[model samples]
Target: MASSPLNEGLISFLATHAPNDAFAETDPVKASQTLFPSTTYTDAERAEISQWVITSSHVGSPSEDAAKSAERLSSLNTHLSSRTTVLGAKPSVADIALYQKLAPVVSNWSPEERTGEQGYHHIVRHVDFVQNSPLFGLKLADKVNIDVDNVIFKIKPIDAKAEKERKKKEKEAAAAASAAASGTATPTTLTGEPAPEGKKGKKEKAKGAAQAAGEAVASIATGKPTAAPEDAQTKKKEKKEKQPKPQKPAPVEKPLSPALIDLRVGHILKAERHPNADSLFVSTIACGDPAGTDNTSEYEGQVVRTVCSGLNGLVPLEEMQNRKIVAVCNLKPVTMRGIKSAAMVLAASPRVVEGEDSHKGPVELVNPPTDAKAGDRVYFEGWEGEPEAVLNPKKKIWESIQPGFTTTDSLEVGFDVEAVPQLSGEGADKKTGVGKLKTAAGLCTVTTLKGATVR
Candidate 1:
C-alpha cells in the first residue's frame, strides 16, 4: 500500500522537532545544546508547530501557495472526521504517531481558549472515543495502560488459549524429534559391548569353534551350557547388584488459612495522641476490601480494623499523618494506662552497635519506601495468613460481670440505670442502682422511684 500522507507528515514533523545539530559535529551532548538552543519552547509556538505538522501530514501534499495549502489542510481535517474512528477505541500507533506529530496543535487547544475549531474537535472526539471503549478491545494488558501527557492509550490482550496451544504444539514437536533421535541410537549389550558380527577371517573362526565346543561339552555334561563370556557374567552380576533408583520426595503440604497470607496494605483514616500518655497515639487504619469492592459487613468490607498503640514515642506526629505502613492488624486488644489499645504498627527497629550508651540508645522508625502506597498489602516471612490486625497489647479486654465487674465480685451483674429527682423537681437524676442497693431479711433489692422527692 502507498504510504499515507499522514505518515509522511509525521516523519517530517519528528525530523524537525528532533533536528540534527550542525555545530556539535558528532558529540550528542553538544548537538543537543545547539539543536534545542533554548531550554524550552513557548506553549503557543509548540502548539502551532504541532497543528501545522498534523494538518500538513494528514491533508497530503502542501502546495507552494499558502492559500492552497490552507484549503487542503481544511479539507483533510474534514476528511479525517468522516473516515477515521479517531479515538473511538484504544489509541492506535497511528493515533500516537499523529498525536506526536500534532502535539503542538493539541496543546494549543487550551481549556482557556480554542483555536482550529474543527481540528480541535476532531482530536477531542477521538480521545473520548478511545477512553470510553472496552480496555480489552484496545489490546491493553491487565492493569496496564499507556499514558502520555495524561492521555491513556489502551491495547487489548492477545488470545491466551491460542498462545498456549501454539506453545504446547511446539513443545510436543520438539519432544517427538528428541524421542526419534534416541530410538535410532545403538543399544548396549548386557556385557556393555557391541553385538558380535558375522565371521571375518581366522580369529573369528577360532573363537566360534571354541565357543561351540564349550557349549556342547557343557550341554552333554549337565544339560545346561555356560556359553556366555566371562565378562558377561561379571556384567550381569554388576547389573543385579546395582542400587535401586531413588524416589522423589513428596511435596510438603501447607495449611490454607488467612493466617498464612499477608494483608498489610491499607490507608490510615484517623490518628489521635493519647490524652494521658505522651508516647502513645491511637490510630484508626482502614484496610479496604482486597476484592476491590466493599462487600463484607463486619467492617463494611474493610479488610483491616482499627489499632491503637504508642507511636508518638517512636515516630513523629507529622510523619504519621496520611502515611501508609505495613502493620499487624489481627491482634488481641490489650489495656495500657487504663485505655484499651488495639493493633500494633510494624516498624523496623534500628540496629544498635555494641557498647552504645543505654540512655542515648539509637532507635529509628522504619518507613515504607516511596513505591508503596496506602492500602498496599505486605507479607512477613514464614507467616501463612493475611494480617488481620495490628499488634497492640493495650487493646485487650477481659471478661467481666456488671458491665465492668470481675468474676471475683460477689454481686455479678450488669449496668443498672436509675433516675434521681432533680432539685428543681422538673427532671429525674440519673444514677447507677448498685449504689442504692438495700439488704433486708437476707435479701438484696435495688429499686428506683422516678419523680420521688427525698428531702
Candidate 2:
C-alpha cells in the first residue's frame, strides 16, 4: 500500500505546531530512527527549556538562574548561525517549540537586550519570524490581540527530592507517635529512659500500706471508720469542680440590601477558540431580549451577545457547549484580542496553587434555575434597577460591584445586599431588626450547588 499525501501534510503540520522532543539526540543517526526527527527532538528541547528556563525563574523578577537560562539559549541560537529557522533551512516543529518558549521571556526583556546587545541576535530574529508566521491564523496587527509579553508559562513537575523528604518525615512522625502511645517516657521522669517500676512502685506501695495500717489503728481506737484527712478531701473536691463546661455559641446575623448590578441567565450558543489569543475563547451567548428592546435601536431587544472569555485552559470545550450560565449583562463592551466582547460569563474556581496548573481543578459555571428564562432580571429582594446600557470600565463600576456578587446559603448567585434602617419605623417587626434580604429572587444559581463560590 502507498502512503497518502496526508502523510507529508501531517508531517508539515506537526513540524510547525507540535515540534521535537525537548531532549532529543542531536546525533543524526539516533535522531533519524523516526520519521519527523525534528518534531521528536524539538519536543524534548521544549520540555528542557520550559523546566530549566521558565519554571526555575520568577516572573517579573530576573534572577541569576534566569540569566543563565537566557545565556544558554543564546549560545544555542548562535550555533544556528544564519539559519532562518530551528533545525534547518525551513521552519519545523522545533522552531515552533523554541519560539513559544523564548517569546514570553524575550518580549519582557529591555530594549538593549531585544536588539542583540545581549548577544542573542539570532534568537531575536527567530522570535520575530515566528511571530509574523501565518500558520497560527491570527491577525496580530490588531492591538486588542494577545500580547506575548503578558504570558506566564508554568510547568509543574512532581519533584522526587521533595517527595522523598515528605516520606522521610512521615516515617519519623509514625515512629514518634508509636513511642508516645506506649508511654515510652512519663512527663515527671527526669531520666532519658523509662523510670524503673521497682524503685517508684515499691516506695508508693510501702507508703500506701503504712497509711492504711495507720488508718486502721486510728479507726479501732476511735471505735468508728475515721474520715479522710480534711486537706486531701478538700483537694479532691476542688479538682473535680475545676473542670470546664462546654457552652453553645450565640448566632450571628448579617445585614442585607438589594443587589447592586444587573446579572442575567445566559445560554452558551457557540464556543470557539480566539484566532488571535491562545488563552481566550470567542463565544456567542443567547440571553433572550433584554428589558428595553424596541424597534428603533440595535441595542434594544438584542437577545444575543458575543463574549470573550479566558476559559481556554480552565474549562473543557465539551463542558461549555450548550450549557446554561450566569453573565454580567451591563459591563461595557470591549475589544479583546480584536474580538468585541459584549458580556462576561460567571464561574467559580479554587485558589491558584503556585507552580501548579491554575485550571487543574473544576471550573463550574454559575448556572440559573430551569424556570428562569433568558433576559429575566437578576436582582436582590430589596434592590431594583433597569439594566444599564453600558457600564464604564474607567469608573471601575464592575470592580466595585464584583466583590458583592456571591452565592447565598441557598446556592443562588446574587448581590450581597446591605442592611439599612427601614424608613417606615417597622424595624421592630422586621426579621433582621432592619431591612432583610431574601436568599433567592431573580438571581442565577443552582439548588444542588449550594454554598459554591461564584467568581
Candidate 3:
C-alpha cells in the first residue's frame, strides 16, 4: 500500500493545490511515511490509479507481472470513461503521476495511434490534459517538446593538480621542441625519418670532415692506418642473433586448486524440470560445505544445494534422484531462468560443439565412488589444493582447465594429460605433451555402464 502509485499521484496533486496542508508534502524523505496513509488503498479511485503506474524508465520489457498490471489499469480506465482525470471531472494528482509514467509513450503516439492500442486512448488523453493544466506549471506543448536526444549536463571537474600536471607535460614537450631547434641537433624523431637536412646537417658534415682529417694525420704519423673502419653494424647484427631467444615459459596449468573447486561427492536428493526453462533440470543435491563450516542459516543443515543443469533430454527424470555425483561447490551462484543455482554438478560429455546439443549422445554423469560419502572431497593424484571461497565466474579459470578434464579408455575421470612439471625444467629444456590423467581418487562408476566418458 505504501508503494501504491495512486497514493503517490494523489499526494502530488494535493501538494500542488494546497501547499500549506500537512497531507500535501512532496519532499520524498519527509513525506515517505505520510504520503501513503493507511487508508490510501481504501479509496477506489486511488487504488485504480496505483495500478497504472506500472512501467518505469528503467524497465525495458513488461514481464508477466507487468502485463497483469497493464490489464488492471485498462479496466480502471474503462470505468473512468470520458473523465479528464482518473477519479472525476477535475484534474488531480492521479492524472499527473500517471501521465509522467506514460508520457514517453503517449507523447510519441498520434491521437488515432493511441486509439489503435487497447488502453492508450485514455492514458494519452490524460497526459495531454495534465501538461495543459496549471497544476503542472507548464503547457503540454512545452513540456512534451523536450529534446531528449540532445540532452546536456555538466560532468565532474578535473582535479586541479591533475590539470596542472597535464599542462606541465604540454609545456615540456613544447620546450623540448624549441631546444632541439636551437641546439642545431638532429633531434630524435618518432617518424623514423631523418630530421630535415637544414643547418643541422651542414654543421654535422663539417664536424665529421675535421674529425676525419685528424684521424688521417694521426694514421700517417704512426705509419699505421686508422684501425680499419669497424664492422660495428655487422657485429651488432651478429650479437643480436647470438643473444639466446627468450623461451616462452611453458604454460602452467593454473587450475582452481582442489580446495578452490570444492569438489565433493553429492547425491541428487530430488530432480524436476525447471518451470521456466525447457532444457534445464532443477535438482536438489546434498553435499557438505567444503570448508567444513556450518551453513545452517542458509543451507539449513540439509547440506543441500539447488543446481540447474541442462540435463533434461539426456538424463531421464526418474534416473536423476538418489544418484551419486561429483559437484563443484565453489563456483559462483548463477540465476538460470529465475532459479538460483547454488552449485554445479560435474558431468562428462563429448567436447561441446557450437549450435549442437550433445544430449543426442550420452551426457554421462561423473559419478562418485560407490563407497564415497556425500562430503568426501574429490582430488586428482598429483594436483592438491582446496576450493577458493568463491569462484570468479567471469575469469576463465574453469575454461582454462576444462580441456584437461577428460576420461580414460577405462572411463576414469581426471586431468587426462601431462607435461614435464614446471619446477623440474628450464627454458627450452621444458617438456610438455599429452599425458595420463593423474588422479588417485577411485573411479566413479555405475555397475551397468562401462568404457564411457562421464559427462
* Top model number, TM-score: 3
The regions of model 1 sitting more than 4 angstroms off are: 1-263, 289-304, 351-361, 369-373, 380-455
* Model 3, CA-based lDDT: 0.52
TM-score of each: 0.25, 0.34, 0.38
**Which candidate, 1 or 3, would have the higher lDDT against the true structure?**
3
- The residue-level lDDT of candidate 3 at 371 comes to 57
Candidate 1, 46: how far from true, in Å?
A: 44
**lDDT of each residue in 219-316, candidate 1, tens digit only:** 44454534544323223334456787999999554332223223344456567798788777766665433322221111211233456665675556
lDDT of 1: 0.38
lDDT by residue (1-455, candidate 3, tens digit) is 54433346445544553333424444322232243221123355444444444432222123437666556557545544434445443233344455555666555645444554343454544565566533234323335542223313322323558666656645544553444445532232211224334443566644443443444445444545543222111122334446768999895545543334567787777899999999899988767432222221112123367899998987789988877788877777888989888888777766556898656756777767765656567776566675566667777566545555666656666664332132225568653432333223466543333433343
The residue-by-residue lDDT of candidate 2 on 128-208, one tens digit each, is: 656553322223332212233432332232355866766664554454344444444231121122233444564454444
Off by over 4 Å in 2: 1-260, 290-303, 351-361, 408-410, 417-443, 446-453
Candidate 2 lDDT at 207 equals 46
Off by over 4 Å in 3: 1-259, 290-301, 352-359, 418-441, 445-455
- What Cα-based lDDT does every candidate model obtain? 0.38, 0.50, 0.52
Candidate 1 vs candidate 2, TM-score winner: 2
